[model samples]
Target chain A: MNFYDGLTFPAAGVIPFEHHRAHTPLYYGIQFNTSGTLRVRINRGREHTLTGPVCFITHPGAFFEYSLAPGERHDFTFFCFAGPRVQEYLRSGLLDLTPMPAAISREHKFVETLRELLRQRELGNYPESVNLLESLLIQLRRQTQISAFLYQTPRLQELVHELRAHPERDWDFEKEAGRLSISTQHFRRIFRRHTGNSPQHYLIQLRLAQAANRLAHSEKPIGMIAAEVGFEDVFYFSHLFRKYYGIPPKKYREEFFV
Target chain B: MNFYDGLTFPAAGVIPFEHHRAHTPLYYGIQFNTSGTLRVRINRGREHTLTGPVCFITHPGAFFEYSLAPGERHDFTFFCFAGPRVQEYLRSGLLDLTPMPAAISREHKFVETLRELLRQRELGNYPESVNLLESLLIQLRRQTQISAFLYQTPRLQELVHELRAHPERDWDFEKEAGRLSISTQHFRRIFRRHTGNSPQHYLIQLRLAQAANRLAHSEKPIGMIAAEVGFEDVFYFSHLFRKYYGIPPKKYREEFFV
Candidate 1:
C-alpha cells in the first residue's frame, strides 16, 4: 500500500562540487542546487545557468552535462528514482521535466525536504525517504506554476516579497505604482496578471494568513493578533477569519493549537 | 520522479460504523481501526477480533469481510491504492499483507498521519496525501516489528509501557521479577528475548532517550534534566549520554535545540 513499495533508489545524496556528464542515465534524476551556480547543458543544447534555489529533472537516456566554476564548491542534492510508473507520469503531464526556478527565498522547503530525504536514505529508512521525495516533487511542481508567473517581472516579484515579509504594513496601491514608475491602473493589471489577485486583496489575504498562523501557534489575545496583522477592528477580523477558515478565531485556536 | 505519480487513489477517508464484504477487491486496501472492535474474516478464515489501534492490508482478489457489532459505531480510516508495484512488494517481502496490532497507545502517529492524509486529499493536495500514506506505511511497518515482540506476553508488555511512561522511576530487576512471579534469571532472559535488552539496560535507554528529548525541547539546565531522568550523578549521566548519542549533552542541546 506504500507509494514506493517496489521502486529502486539507486543513489541519493548531497554532493559538493559535482561535475558529471551522463550520456544515457539508467534512471530518472531530480537535482536541486543549494548554493553557488550550476551550468547544465541538455542534449547538446545551450547551457543554462542555475543560481540560488533551483531544480531540474532528467529522464533515462537524456544526454546532459552539469558542472560548476573552476575551484568552486557548491552543495546540491540529487535523487535517482526508477519505476514503470515514472514513464506513465511523464506521459500524463503530471510530472513536468523542464528545469524550474524554485521560490527565490532561502526559507523554501525544497532544500530542506531534499536534505531530510537524504538523511532518511542514509539512515536506511527507505519508506520515509520515498515519502519525502513524493512530497518534494509535489512542492516543486506547485512552485513551478507559481514561480513561472512571479519571476516574469522582477519589480512585481520584489513587491510581492515585501508584502509577504511585512503583511502588517499599510501598503498603498498608488505608492506602490509610483515606486514602480507606472499608473495605478497599469500596476493593478500587471500585479493581478502575475499574482492572480489585486494589490489590496492580496494584502488582505496575506494578513489573514498571518493572523491564522498566529492564532494556531501563539496564545496571544484575538484582538492583539488582529491588530498585529493590520486589522484594527476585532469584529471585522473575526468575520474575515470565519469567512476564510469556516471557523471563528477562538475555535480555530482551540482546535489547532496544541 | 515522484512516487505515486501514476498510481490511482480510488478512495481514502474515515468512515464510521463501517461494514463491508469484498469477494474480490479491485484495488489494494489498507484500513486502521480508530475506536471500537472490528471483526475481520480473511479468505473465509476464522474471524479475528481487532481491538484498540490496529491495521490490516487487503490486496486485489482477496476475499474478506469486516464488520462491527449491530448498532455499534466505530471510527476507522480506509485507503485504496492501486499500482503495478503493489505485487512486487508483496513478492519481495517488503510489504506484509497481514493484520498487525499497532502500538497499544492512543498517541501513535498512525491515526494522526491517516487523518492528515485524508485532509490533504479532501483539499485536493494529491502529492501530499500520497506522501503521508507512504510515511504512514513506514510507521506501521516499523511498529509491526516492535509490537509483535512486545505483545508476546501481556505482563512484559505492561512493564515496558510502564517503563516508557515513567522512565525516571527507580526500577529494580528483582522487584519486577518478584511482581511477575518469576525467578530473576528467567525474568532477565524473557525480557531480553522480548525487548532485545536486559531490563536494566532497557531502562537506561529509556531514561537516556527522555533526557535527549528534554535537551532538545526544553531550556532546563543539564544537571536538572539529568536528575529528572533519575540520574543523580551528572558526570555519569553525561558519560552514558555521550556513549549513546555520540555527543555530550551540552553539545547536543546546543546543536539541536532551536
Candidate 2:
C-alpha cells in the first residue's frame, strides 16, 4: 500500500507546559521535546526523562503520563495521528511506539521540517502535509537507531558531540584515540561501527555542513567561511564542497541563499 | 505497494550550463530550473520555456531535448529516478509527466527540501532520502494542479503575485475585483474555487507567514515585526499568530530560531 495514504492527522501544535500532566491520549502521538525536560511514564512503568532535542512516541490507550518540573517550562511539538496504516504498522512490528525518547542530532533540520508541516497544514495542503509527516517519522526512526548504538558507546558519543560542536578545531585521530586509551586502529573500527563514518570523514562532513549553513544564511566570504570551518586551503575546500554538494560554492550560494 | 520503494536515484546533481543542449535521457528525470530559463522539446513537439523557480519532468527513452541561451548560464538541479513503481504509476495514469513545467510558489521550501534530500543521500540515510523524494514529488503534483487553475485567470494570478510580494500592504478586495471589472461576490467565488481560499484569508495567511519568517530569521522585536507585517495592534497580531501557529511569537522564536 502507498505509505503516505491512510494516515490522518487530527491535531498538531507547538505547546508549552509547566508542571502539567496528561494521561492516556485518545490517539497515537508523536512528541518532540524542543526545550527544557519532560518526564513520561508508560503504563506506570519507569519514568523516562526526555531532554530538549529529542523525540518519543505514544500509542493509543497506552496509559502514558507526561509532566514537567515545577517552575520549569517545557516547549514541545505534539502530533496526533491515527489510521488503518498506523494500526497495520504497529501490528506488523514496523513501528515501535515506545515511551523512551531518542536524541536528535540535527535539531535544526527537525525543527525546519516541523515548521514546514505546520505551514502546509495551515494552508490545507494535504499532499505536502502527508509527505512532511512521513519525513518526520523517518527522521525519528533513524534517530532511534543512532541513539541505540550510541548508548552502548558513551565515550564515542561524547566524542561525536564534541566533533559537532567544534568542527573548526584541529582534530587528530591518534590524539583522540590516545585520550580514549585505545589504539588508533581500534578507535577507527569502533567509531565507524557506531557512527557509520570514519573519524576523518565525519569531521570533514561536519565542517562542510557548517560551511554550507553559512553559505546559505550569511553574507560571509567563501574563503572566510572555509577558514571558519577548519579548512586552511580555500581551493581545496571549494573542490571538496563541489564533490559533496554537486555544485561550486559560489553557485550554491547564488542558487540557494534566500 | 509502498510509494517510496522501487525508485532508485542513480545520479543527481546541481549543474550549470551555458548555450548547451542535451537529448533524451536513459532514465526518467526531474529538473528544477534554479537560475535562467530552460527550453525543452519533447518528441519534436512545441518547445516549452521553463523560467527559474519552475520544475519539469522527463520520461525515459523519450525523444526530448533541452537547451540554454547563449551567454546565459542556467543552474538547475536534476534528479534521475526510475523503477517498476514508476512504470506502474505511468501505466495507471497516476503521474502526468508532461513536458510543460509548473511554477513553484514556495521556492524556499522547495530548495530546503532538496538540500535536505542531498544531505541524507550523502550520509547514506535511505529512509530520509526516500521520504524527501516522495515529498518533492507530491509538491510537484500539487503545483501542477495549482498552475492549471492559475493559468486560466491571468488577472487574478497577477494579483496573487502582488499579494505574495507585499502582504504588508492594506488590500481592498472590492477594489481588486473592480480593477478586473468583476463584482466582489464573483471575485470571492472564483478566487476560492481556484485557490482553495478566500482572498481575505489568503492575504492574512501571507502576512502571518511573513511575520513568522521574520521571527525565525531576525532578532527584531515582536512588536516591530507585527507592525511591519501590517498589524496595527501588537496584541491582535500575537493573538492571530498563536491561533494560526499554535504558539506565541516569542515562544516560536525561542524554539525555532537558530
Candidate 3:
C-alpha cells in the first residue's frame, strides 16, 4: 500500500548531494553518528550540524532538503507515511512536523523500535506496521519536546508522572502549582511548553486515554469506567470522549476490542 | 532471505481442499476454534478433527491436506520456515515435527505470542520477528509434550518447573526420582517421552539456554556464567556449549552481543 518503508543505513561512501521534494508526504528520519558529522537543511532553515542521534520530521506538503559534507559519513533509517490519518495526527499535534531537527544521544530502545517497524514491512505485515508506526510517532513526540530545561524542572515531571499513573485522582491546578512552589499561571505556561498541552487539557487527555485502554482491554461497564477515571457524570465523560475521539466510548471499545 | 512467513486464518466457507507440492518448507499452524471445527489429514494419516485450539507441524517434503465441514467456520494462523537453522533446530529436538495433528485446549499465552509475532511482521521488523518466533517454538515444545496425564501429575509438572527456574541446582536423577516415588530408569523414560529429552539432557539444554541468554545480555565472565549454571568445570561447559551451538561461549557472546 506504500504506507511505509525502512532499512538500515547503507554502506556506500559519502558524496556531497542534495534532495528536494516539493510536495512530499510526512517524512520521519532517525540518524545516528558513530563518529563524524551530518548537516541537514529543512525548508529555508540554516544548515544544522547533527552529531550523535538526530530525529527530523516534515509535515505533509512541506519541502524537504538534505545534504552531506564531502567524505563525511552517518548512519540513518527513515519512514514516510501519506494518508488521511497522518494529516489528522499532524493537525491534532500528536505528531510534530516542525521543520527544525532535534539531536539527542543514541537511544537504543528507539533505534530498536524503528528497526522493528522495518522488519514488519519485510514480512508484509502491513496492519501491524502501521500500528507500530503510530506508536513511534508518540515516542518521537515525547523525545522532541523533552529538553534540558524540562529535566531541570523535576517537579513538573513528577506531576505528569503522578497524573498519568493515577488519573482517577481529583487534580486541582492551584493545589498542584502550590505543591510545586510555582504560581498556577506559571505552572500552566511551562507545562504547555513542555507537553504541548495546558495542565487541564493534558489531564483530560490522560483520563480519556486510560478510559479507552480499560474499555478495550477490560469488560468494565461504561458508567463504571467513567467513574473510575474521575468522572462524576457519565454523560459528561461520554460527551468529552466523543469530542476528542470522534467516536463515542462504546463504539471505540467495539472497534478496538482485541 | 525467505526465513519465515505467517498469516492469520481467512474467513471462507469450507469445501474439500488438497494442498500438495513436491518439496514444501517446514510448516507450523496454530488454529483456534472460535466457532466451528477443522479437519486435517497428513500424509495418508487418518483424518483428525481439531475442535479446540490445535497446533500441528509438518516436516519438509511432506504432503499436507486439510478441510472443514460444509457450513462450518474456523479460525487459523500459520507459519513456514525454510532455513538451515530450522533444520538444526529440528535435529536437536527443540521443535517437534511429528505428522499427527495434536488438538490442545486454548492457551491464552500461546495465542498472544503468535499475535505478537504477527504484529512484528506487520511492522516489517524481521529481526525481532524471528527472535519472537524462536521463543514461540520453545513455548510450543513445552505445550506439545504436556499431556493430560502430565497435568494430573502435579509433582512432575512442579519438578520440570523447578528445573527450569533453577538450573543451577545440583540435581541427581535417583534422588529426584525417589522424591517422586519412581525408579530412576522410569523417571528417565517418562521425562524423555514428555519433554522429548532425557532429564539430564533436558537440564543441560536448559542450563545452556540460560547461559546463552546471560552472555548476550550481561557482561559476566565465561567462567562465572559456567559455574552459575551448575558447571563446576568451565572447560567441560565450554566443550558442550561449542558442541551444541557450533561456537564456543565467548564466540557466541560476540556474535549476539547487541
Candidate 4:
C-alpha cells in the first residue's frame, strides 16, 4: 500500500477534538489530530502538553489519547509511515536530535516559512500539500539535530550565541574561547566535532552568512557593511568578502538585491 | 574533502555575473517555476528557451550558462551535492526526468522552501540548513514518478481551454479523444501518462484547484464556484467535493474562503 494513500480524517465544522487511534495490523494505533490543548499520555506515561505547535510520532501498538481546552483553537495533521527506518533510528539511538538554529531563532523567517507551509497544507492541497509538509518535517528534523549539536558542547553553544549576538565583531580571538568552559585547544576540537568548524572558521562562516544576507536583502555599501561586521580595514574586508563569496561585495548586492 | 569544507569563491565588488558563473558549479539544475522564462546556452552549442520550471543537471566538465529575463523573473532554488547517490542517479538515466506532476509540484515547494532556508543560513544555522537541503533533494527526485501518475493529459488541453473560456455551460456529451487524433483508450493512457490521471479526473482536479484559488483569494460562493466549473447541481457538487476532499463545501468556504 502507498503511504497515506487511503487515509484521511474528518475536519468538518469546528473540530473541537479530533484524535486518531488505530490498531491497524500494518502499523498499530490510529493517528490523531485535534485542536486546542490535547493532553496526551503516551505508553511511556508521559503527559505531552501542546500549547501552540506540537508533533510526536507514536510507534506500533502505542496507546494514546487527547483532550482539548474550551475556546482554545487547535488543529493537527498527522500520519504514520510504517518502515524499518524508524526502528533502525530508534535502535541506533540516532533519533535523539537537538534543537536547530532555525528553532532557536524561532521568531526568524525560517520558522515562519514553515508555519506558512503548514497553514497551506491545512488548507488542503493534498498532493502538493503533502510535499510541503514533508519539507517542513525534513527541516524540523534538521533543526533538531542542530540544536543537539550546539547543546552537545558548551563552547560551541556560547560561541554560536556570541556570533548571533554580535555578528559585526571581528572574532579571530582566543579570548571568547577562554570565556567558555574549556581550554582553547579542547574547545576548538569539540566545536569542530559538533559544528565541523574551528572557532575562527565558524565565526567567518557566520560573518559571511550575515554578509550574504545583507548583500541579498540590503543595499548597504561595502564599506558600511565592512564596518558593521567589524572589519576595520576596508580593503581587507573587501578582500575577505570576495574570497569568501567569490564575488565582490558590490556585485553580490546588485545581482541579488537588484 | 568536505562537500563545502573550504571551497571559497571570493571576488571583487557586487558579485560579478561572470565570477558567479565561473566559481559555483551547477550540480543539479532544474527549473520549477512555471510561467517563467530562462535564456540559457550550454556546451552543446545550442541556444535554448525554457518555459515553465525544469531541473537541469550539468556535469562538472560541462560548460554551462543561463540568465533570467528582466520582466520574466524566475523563482527557483537548487542544491549541489557530490556524493555516491547523486552520481548513481546521473549514471542510471533516472534523473533525466520530464516534469511529471508529483515531482514538479514537489520541486516547486522544495525550491521555494530552500530559498528561504539558504537566506537564513547566514544566521549561523548550518546544521539545520544542511539537513533540510539534504532531504529536500531527495523529495525532489521522489516526486517525479508520483507526479507522472497524477498530471492531466495533453489530449485534454484544447477541451480544457474551451471549458475555461466558458466554464459556466454544462460541458458534456462530448468526446475529445477523437478530435485529438487518437482512440479514447490511447488518449486516456497517454493523458494519464503525462498528467497522472484520467481526463475527467484532471478536469475535476483543475476545477478544484481553481475553485480553491477563487475561494481563498476571492469572495466567490460555493454555488458560483460550482457554476463557474460547470457543475449545475449544487448538492452533487458538494458531494463530489466531500468525497474527494473529506469535507463539506461549507468547510472549504470557511477555511479557505476570504
Candidate 5:
C-alpha cells in the first residue's frame, strides 16, 4: 500500500484535562511528552505515566486514552499514520511502544529528529517524510538496545559514539585505536572508508556539532563552551568555527539565543 | 535562527527550461523531480540531471544553475530553507546533498513524507513542520550509513516491516511467530501487550490497507485485487472493505482511481 493514502500528521499540541476517548481503529500515533506528566491507558490496560522527553506509540483500534496528571498542563507532539499497516502492526503487537528515549541526550536527539521530519513534510517532500518515519522508529529501537548499528567499522562506530557522548574527550587516532584494541593504521583506513573523512576531520566535525548544539540551546559563554568542547585556544576555536559555520561563534549564538 | 524563520515551501510543480542563474546567496534548496528530467549546476560545477523520482540539494552562494533537459517536460518539488543554519551547514559541507534516495522504494518514501509535511504546513502546524524537517535530515544521514533504526522488539519490528513491504504475504501468527523462533501462546501475549491486538486481526488490516492502496492507484478489477491481497472470497472481501472504508470496493476505486 502506498503509505501516503491513509497517513495523517495532525497539528501537534497540548490536550487539556479531558482525555481523548477510545475511537475506531484508524490511525497509528507517536506521541512525545514535551512538558508536565501525561497519563495514558490502552483499553483497560494499566495507567502509564509519560514524563518530559519521553514518547509512546499507539495502535489503531486500541481504545486509547490520555490526560495530564491532575493540575498539570500537558504538552506533546504527535505524528500519526493511518492505514492498514498501522492496524496490522497493532494487532501483531508490533505497534506497542512506550516511554522511549529514557536518557536526556537520546530524548533531545529524538525531538530534533522529529523537528526535521516536520520540516521536510512542510516542504512537500513526501518520500523523505516516509524515510524519516522509518528513521524515527529505528532511533527509538536503538535506545531500546535492539542493535541499530551505523554501517561503519565497529571501532570507528565506538569512537564516534564516545565522541558524541563526551565531546570534551581528548581524542586522537592513536588513542582511539588503542582503546579499541586495533592498530592506528588500520583504524585510519577503516574510519575513512566508512565516514569519508580523516579521523581528525571527523573529530573536528563532532566537536563543532556539540558546540552548535550548546550555542543554540544553552547560555554558556563562548570561551567556556570552546574549552568544554576541547578547544584549548578560544581564538583558534572562534576562527575555525567562523570558517566552518560561516559566522563567528558569538554571532551564531546571538542569532539563536537572542 | 529558527529553522522555520526563513523557510519557504515553494509551490511544488515545475520550472521551465529557462535556467535559474546564480545570484547572491539567498535560499538553500532540496529539489525532487517527480516527472521528466531537470538539469542543474552549482556555480560552474558539472551538470547534474534529475530524472523522475530523483532529488538534489543546492546550497546558497554557489551561483546556482538549473534548466530542463533538452526536449523533456520537467515537473518537480523544491524545498527551500533560508537563514544562517542553512548557510552554515552548506559551508561546513553538511548540506552538500545530491540525488538522494537513489532506490525507487526509498525515493517514493521521501516524496510521501514531503507531501505530509506540506499538509501540516497548510494547516498552519508550524511547530510540527519544523520538527519534521529535522527528522528528514536525520533520515537522510541514516541512509548515508550515518545510521537509522526501528524501535520495537526485533522479531515484531521485522514482522511489521514485512507487512509494510509486502502486505499481500499470507501472514498468520502461528507461522510468523514460529519463523521468529517463538511459541504462538507467548507470541500472542507479547503481541497484545505491544500492539493491543491479536495477530489474526493485524493480518486482516494489512490486507485491507493493500486493497485500499491498489484501489486508489491502479485500474485493476476489485475481485482481482481482493484475491491478490489474499482474500479468497471476493464477496467477503468486498463486504469487509466497504465496512472499513465506508464505500464499496468498486465505488472506492471509482472515487479515487478514476
Candidate 6:
C-alpha cells in the first residue's frame, strides 16, 4: 500500500545486504556514495530503475528488490500510500516510470514545486505540506500517465458505479471485500493501495463530492441531499460538509443561491 | 481562539451559521449578503449592529460576541485565523478595520480560494483534499498583513530566534512546551492558533528552509551541514531534505552551488 515501495532513495543507511521479498506491495528505495556499488535483484518481476541525483517517479504494481554487495553501503528514503484510486492510476499507465535524479532542477518546475510543498510541510506548515504533497502526488500520477488506473480497473469501475447509484447506502471493507472474495486485510490494503482510502472512506468521499456538485448546481435542501447521499442525519451531513468545506451547509447553500 | 466573534451577519431562515471563539482573546469577522440586507447584533457587553456581505479580519486579545439576525440571507462564507502574527498585525494597524461591502470582489481572490478549498475537502477528496486546503490556508494568511502578530509575541519571538540561532535541532514539542510553562496541548493549540503550527513542526520547517538556502548557495558536505543544523542523523536528515526539496543533500549542494 506504500507508494514509496515503488520508490527507494537515501533516507536510511544502505547496509550491504539483501533480503528476498521482505516487503510485499511496497516501494523500496536506496542510495549510495562512492563507498559502495549498488546491486539489485529483480528476482520476482519487472521494474524500471534510474541512477542520478534528481527526482523520478515509481509506477504502481511494478516489483523489484535492491541492495548493495558485501562491504557495501547505500542510503535511501521512501514511504507508501494506498487506496483503490492509487491502484487505478497504477494500472492505467498514467504515472511515469522514469527516475529523475532525486534533486532540484530549474527545468523541472513541477519537481521544484513538489519540493517546495515537501519543504513547507516539513516546516510544520501542515496546511502547506498537505497542499503541496497532494499536488505533487496528483502531478506525479498525471504526468507519468498513471491516471488511467481508475478507468482500467473494472473492479473500481463497478464499485464507483454501484456507489454512485446508491450513494445513500453504507459501505464497508469487509462487505465489499467479501463481495470481491479477498481477505479483509488484503482488501483493505488494496483498497488503500489503489484508491488512497478504505472502502468506507472512499464511499463517503464519492458521496460528498457528488453532493457538492448538486449543492453548487442544483436547488435542493441539505436534508434531501443528506438523505440522497445516504447520510441518515442531516445535521451529521452538514457537519461533514462544514468540516470538509469550512462552511456550514446552509451557508454554502445561501452563497450559491440568493 | 475562534476568529468569528464580535461580528454578525444577516440570517435568512436558518442559512447555516458557524462561528468559533476563544475567551482569553477576541476577534471579529463582519459579513454581508449578496442581494438582501444582512442584520447583525453584538448583544453582549456592547450593543452594535451592522449589515452587508462584507468581511473583516479579526485579531486576537480582543473580546466581543456577534450574531447575524434572521432576515435576508444570501451566499456568504468566512473564517478567522489568528497567531502571534495576527495580534501583531492588529496592533500594527496592517489591516485597516474599515467597513467593506459583502460583495465577493475579484481582488479578494484568497476568499474565493478559501471557499473552493472548503468545497474540495467537503467533497471528501481525501488524498487530494489536504494539499488544496493547506494552500488555501497559506494563501489566506499571506493575504493578511503581519505586524504584532507576525513579530511581537514573546513566545513567537523566542521561537523564531531559537529557530534562527540553531538551524538543526530535532526539536521535541513536549520539551519545548514544558519550557513554555504550558501543557503540550496548550502549546500546540496556541502556537498553531498564531503561527499555524505546533512548536516543533515550525522548527523543522525553519531548519529545512535554512538548509535549502545553503544547498542553493553554499558548498558544504551534507553530512556536516546536517550536523550543524542539529540533525544528529545525517542519513535521516538528508532523506528529509530530499523528500522536501526533491533532491538529496549532496545533489542539492551540487545543483545550486554552481
User: Model 6 in CAPRI terms: which quality?
Assistant: incorrect
Error of 1 at B236 (Å): 50
Candidate 2 reaches a DockQ of 0.13
Judged by DockQ cut-offs, is candidate 1 incorrect, acceptable, medium or high? incorrect
Interface RMSD of each: 12.9, 11.8, 18.2, 11.2, 16.3, 15.4
Q: lDDT tens digits, residues A107-144, model 1?
A: 46566677777777654455677677767767776677
Error of 2 at A214 (Å): 30
lDDT of 3 by residue, A1-258 (tens): 121222221111111222222333322333333334556666666777766666666444555565544565545455544545555565666666563566655467567667777775543344445555655665565566565436546778777878778878999989988988888888888887665567888788778867877886799899999999999899999999887665689886764454
Model 3 has a DockQ score of: 0.02
lDDT of 4 by residue, A1-258 (tens): 122233232221223334433221223111223334556665546666655444444444545455556566555444333334444344433332222112223324334544554454444333343334344444444555456666756456666677777867756557766666567787677666556567677666667657766777677777777777767788887787776665677776664452
Stretches > 4 Å off in candidate 5: A1-25, A84-105, A115-125, A146-258, B1-258
Q: What would the TM-scores of all predictions be?
A: 0.43, 0.60, 0.36, 0.49, 0.31, 0.39
lDDT of 5 by residue, B1-258 (tens): 121343433222234443344443334555666666666666677887656666666555467666655566655555555554454444543344543333223666577667766665544333345445555554454344211122224667567666657667667778877887778887786665443346777667668867876886788888899999989999999888876665688775653342
DockQ, all candidates in order: 0.11, 0.13, 0.02, 0.09, 0.02, 0.14
Q: What digit string (tens of lDDT, one per residue) describes model 2 on residues B1-258?
A: 132456655456676664554566655777787767778788888888867777888776678677777567667787666666776556533366862777788889788888878777655455567677777776676677567656655688778878878889989999999998889998898787555578988788778878877887799999999999999999999999886765689986764453
TM-score of chain B of each: 0.55, 0.56, 0.55, 0.42, 0.43, 0.45
Best by lDDT: 2
Clashes of each: 0, 1, 13, 49, 50, 94
lDDT of 6 at B238: 80
Off by more than 4 A, model 4: A1-15, A18-35, A44-50, A69-76, A84-133, A138-158, A163-258, B1-38, B50-57, B66-81, B88-111, B124-153, B156-258
Which whole-number lDDT from 0 to 100 does residue B187 have in model 1?
85
Q: What is the TM-score of chain A alone in each candidate?
A: 0.55, 0.56, 0.56, 0.46, 0.45, 0.44
